[model samples]
Structures are given as C-alpha cells and as structure tokens.
Target: MRGWWQDLTDLVLPAECAGCGTPRTVLCPRCRAALAGGVPRRVRPVPEPPGLPAVYAAAAYADEVRAAVLAHKERGLISLAAPLGAALAGAVRAGLRGTAAGPPGTAGAPGGHGGGPAGGGRAPVLLVPVPSARQAVRARGHDPTRRIALAAAAGLRRGGVAARVLAVLRQRRGVSDQSGLGSRQRRENLTGALTTAPHGAALLRAGPVVLVDDLMTTGTSLAEAARAVTSAVYAARVREEMEAYRTGRSRKEGNPVYRASEMRRAYGAGHVICAAVVAASPDSVVENQELTKNVHRCR
Candidate 1:
C-alpha cells in the first residue's frame, strides 16, 4: 500500500525504478533496455478474433515489462509514459514498414507533414487510442492509453514519422470488468461496445491510422476498435452516396464504382488498418510465430 506522500513524490520525482525497483531512477538502465531491446514483432492471439487488425508489439508481457506497464497504468506513474511510448513508437514503425503510403510526392507519402524539405508534403499518421471506460478513466484521474498515444505521437514526430494522436473512439455501453475473463468471454463482452465520434471518420481520412494501446492480453479490445473504425468509415461512404443521389447527381458523381475507388484511396492497402502496442501476452507472441513467418515470407 502507498501513502499520500509516496504518491505525491511518485508524481513529482520517482525514487525507484518502476520495472525493477532499482534506486534513484524512474526506470533504471537495465529495465529500460529490457523494455526497448528487441525488434518489434507481429503478434496474434490464438483463435484470432475476426476483424482484428495486424498488431505489432515491442515486447512480451512478462517479467519487467509487465511490472512497468502495471506501474504506469495502475499506479499512475506518469513519468514512465515516455519510455513506454518510445517502445510503442518502435512497434508502430515496424507495423507501418513497407505499408502503402500513396505514391511519392503525393499526400500521405513519407515526410508529408510540412512543405519543408523534411516534410515532403506527406500527411501525418493518425494514432487512434482505444478508449478506456468512462468509470475507469475517472478512477485513474487520467486516460493511460491516450497519454501513451500522445507520447508515442511525439516520439514519432521527433523521428520524422509525422504522427498525431486522435482520441476518436468511445465506449457506447458499459462492460463488466475483463479481469479473469477468457478470450471468448472477453470478445462477447466487448462486441459492438465501441463507436467513433461523429467527426472521427473525417479525421481518420487525414492519413493512415494506427490503433494503439498500452498492452494487449487477448486482443478483444483492438478487434472491437477496428470494427468500430471500419463501420464508421463505411457509414460515411454510404451517407455521401445517399446525399449525392438525393441531389440527383450523375453516375460520375455518386456511382458505386466511384465510391469503391474512393474508399480504396482513402484506406490505402490493408496496411492502413493495423494496430500497435507496447506489449503483448507471451502466449500471443508464441502462438503467432507461424503466422509471422508466413507474413514475412509473403513480404
């Protein structure tokens, strides 16, 4: 248990490493290296849930990694967000590697954030955080995932990736605590539980989007998030077509052919619909090995 002074001190100046309790550092060198050492890898839960976007994780959810995540999330050690966000940024870059970003010298291309030589007219990548439950956010006094996403976006920008955080997903209903829930139960509990804000679809159109979270256990949350995003984008397309038809626009203006092409352009290739996380369950990493091999083979 922690006292008020401890909490205050933790918020201001952490005295011990969040991952290994090494003295006099928010995160000691050993644990920091552990968190960010490995190359980010593709991960998938066994019996992969439908609509789950491709996910990349910086490390397995074990040992020091798990402790660090818990310290930052449950204990509200805000300073840890920087290291965690750096790890997440690595995963995001790995996930986006080789992904289509439109032709060079066009919008959404690499370095598209500014007209400056570094920016090259490329649009910033959008980082959509999985929304936490309202009650949970109130209890924690901060949205951990969103904070991490913001940190990750900052890191990405500093690295010339041109990223921005977009907190556009929301929970549409209440859910029982996911603790102790199996994969199937978690999936059932989260189905249709999330939706995008009215303006979320338009915001997502700014560039390729990457769903981000602090940790992934069963991947139920990310699947739901992906579903909500795709649904909202599809709904927006429908509305555009309906409005065009109502206005008596010609086939060139509102035809299915044109809409399909527009959707492809907006979403790019399958790479546009992917996710990244700081860590994933060890089981997921192991279970996904064969799939990862196949993915690499194709690439």
Candidate 2:
C-alpha cells in the first residue's frame, strides 16, 4: 500500500523543513514558532451556530498551518502529532485557566480540570477529540484527530496535569463534503451527526468537557458536537435534578451543551483559547464569506 511506503519514508526520510525545505530539521525553530504561538483565541466562523461550546482552535486553517494539518491527516506524518498536540495543550491550558478564574462549571468539579502543574490544588482535565467520519478514516487509513488528542493528552500529563482522552465521541451519521457549503448548509449537513462515547454520557457529565478538533472552518462541526455533548450533559443534569427533587434536593442552572456563541464571545473577549500546530493568520476568517476557490472547498 502507498500508505505503508509513505509511513516508512516519513520516518526513514532524512531531515527537511516542513515549512521551507531547510535541511537538518523537519520543523525548524522559526517554523515551529508559527505553531508554538499557541494563543487560544475564541474563533467564530462567519455563520456561527447554536449549542456549540466555546471552541478554541489551535491555529488558523491556512498556509503552512493548513499544509501541516493536511500532512498529518492525509500523509501519515504521524510524527507531527507531538508538535500539534503541544499546541493543543497550550490552548487547553488557556481554557482551563479562564474557566478556573470564573465560577464552577463541570470543569470546576473534581477530576474535571486536566493537565495543570501540581503547584496548586488544580484538578485533572479531560480531552475529548471530535470524532471522524468512517469514510474519512477509511480513505486516509488513520484517525488523525484521535491520534492528535492522544498525543495532546500525553503532553498534558507530562506537564503534571492528569490528562486523559475521552475517546467516546462518535459520528452517528454521514455528512456531505464540507468544501463548498456555507455555514448554514454545513450546519444542516451535520445535525444529529454525533453522540457521546457509548454510555459515555455519565463520564462526560461528571465534569467540564472540552471538545477538540483539528480545524474549524464554519465551526459547524464543533457546534454540532457541542450540541451532542450538551444533550448528554443536560440529560445527566435533568436526571440528577429529578433524583434531587425526589429526595428534597435542587438542580443548577445552565445546561451542559457547548455553544459556538460561547466560543465566539470567548475569542472576542479572549476567554477560551484554541491553538493548532499550523495555521493561517487569524485574518483568514474573511475567506469564509465565499468558497475559497484557491484551495480545497466543498464546492
């Protein structure tokens, strides 16, 4: 299989910069800087949707960033997961820190927060990777997002945070290609497409859930995923509320669904943070207005 050869060549192949073809380094410091500037800003796709948690993308999905993502996703550049996960780790840290400063959400509960240094009483955190469609995996012969999530979890643990990947998210439906679709179209395409890992509702409901994705264009995927997670959380919350009411207890406000609005507001206000190993400048948000004919577009 070409994939097998590619995988072997990737490891046996000598040093060459993924960014600028510089020898002796697959990813040079300058290029790495492009990724390590992991400031997780709230990114809003033009046609933002509802029920999506505040998502922090790790990088702009353009240029070298785009290439790097594609390299990992399509090419079997499995080695790239480390650096990519490193960027995600930074974004995750930012999200946890911001939430920690505020009131207690599921993230505030014990075992919810992840990957914080042991200097304080910071609890562990959870990393939930957005699931990939079966077709995509079959085509690529790998699960890129899941692989990256695992790497990110490892990186988080190394930093003294008890990081774990909740490999429970699953795609329940097939979506049309997202190349040419507008945000609205994208939204419709992905409705009810995901659910928590089998019986994972309980574990996810146990605390704050951060949904991780490799790229966020219109952010429809993230939004839809948040809805699924929220449904799981809300169902758990409602269950608890009913049980509490039956036992003379009370429930809390705000359901568990992650919303795109939350993430947009966070990015706008610098609250939730997202990072990608490689990304175009943040200015690329404008490209969402029309199908980017220059590169890959669903249309």
- Winning model by lDDT: 1
lDDT of 1 by residue, 126-177 (tens): 8999999999888877799999999998888787677788899999999999
- List lDDT for all candidates, in order: 0.77, 0.60
Candidate 1 lDDT (Cα, whole model)? 0.77
Each prediction's TM-score versus the true structure: 0.84, 0.75
Q: Lowest lDDT 10-mer window, candidate 1?
A: 290-299
Q: Model 2 compared with the native: what TM-score?
A: 0.75
Look at candidate 1 and tell me the lDDT of residue 207: 65
For candidate 1, give the lDDT of residue 218.
91
Tens-digit lDDT track for model 2 on 1-299?
24677766676673576655677655667556556553555455555677655555455665556666777788667767778888777667655654543223223223443343443433345567778888888888899888888888788778876657777778887779888887788888999988877778767643345667777776777777767766665566557666776786553443213333443232111121222222333533432322232223211
